[model samples]
Target: MAQSFGTFDIAVLDGGQYDPRWPLIHMTPEEAVRAADDMGVKSMILTHVGKFCISAHSWDEPFNRVVEASQGKDFRLLTPKIGKPIRLDGAEQSFSRWWEDIN
Candidate 1:
């Protein structure tokens, strides 16, 4: 789908459960990152993190790891705070609205 669309950027919401049998509701963080990189996607943002990953108070760890893994590569990983705007110059893309409540 990315090839057909030729999209430069992609966002994965609730993507922390890559394994279908993991008893989680989303894709694994690593799998999501790898898939994005393999697809030649230039940027990826992870969302919909589950309570299990957050109650531990280290939800950002996995996010940071994905970002580090994509460093110096064509892919740029980001975890934007709700309501912040993200702009991509060459792509002419602007992501201004986040969650509705925050916006």
Candidate 2:
């Protein structure tokens, strides 16, 4: 899949899970940063992370780690909390906040 994309400026990997088969597969937080750097991807966002496995605080560790690792690199890795708005371009907007109101 990474090869097919051929180094996109912003590659948003929706799911956190990683497959080892693909060399470019970001199986770990560190790997994600490396891949984005190598591919010249400007931004990488990890999605599909929720409270299902560990607490929100616990998840932040790995997320922050990736961000720190990307420091000084051209790419930016981010893991935003629920409710934050990400402005892509024009009027298009995306929210990171989970739908807690939904029941």
Candidate 3:
């Protein structure tokens, strides 16, 4: 749906809260990547995370899995801080593994 726009090349996906019982409601890392592909998204930013234990995976799992799933893909997976700016030109490459310290 997002690919309808000529400039809508980036997709900010909902990467939080995944459960096998409700696959239709939540999107996993792989699923999100597939969606980006479906929408012809050139870059992807994962949001709606860092809180709420709504699934089996840990809080940090989403970012990690997204990174893993993005292997060999043409699109970029961006994970930035709350206030940090994400470059629309896809030149700024910064990814903070913020959840590594948390247990």
Task: Report the number of the highest-lDDT candidate.
Answer: 3
Tell me which of candidates 1 and 3 scores higher on lDDT.
3
Tens digits of per-residue lDDT, candidate 3, 1-103, equal 6546543578988867888898888788888887887777788987657766778887888888988888887777777765778888757677777667567
* Residue 31 lDDT (model 1): 65
Cα RMSDs, all models: 6.4, 6.7, 2.5
Candidate 1 residues lying further than 4 Å off, grouped into runs, are: 1-7, 17-24, 50-57, 91-103
Query: Which residue pairs in candidate 2 collide?
Result: 82-97, 83-97
Give the winner by lDDT: 2 or 3.
3
TM-score of 1: 0.57
Give me the candidate number with maximum TM-score. 3
User: What's model 1's lDDT at 19?
Assistant: 45
Model 3 TM: 0.79
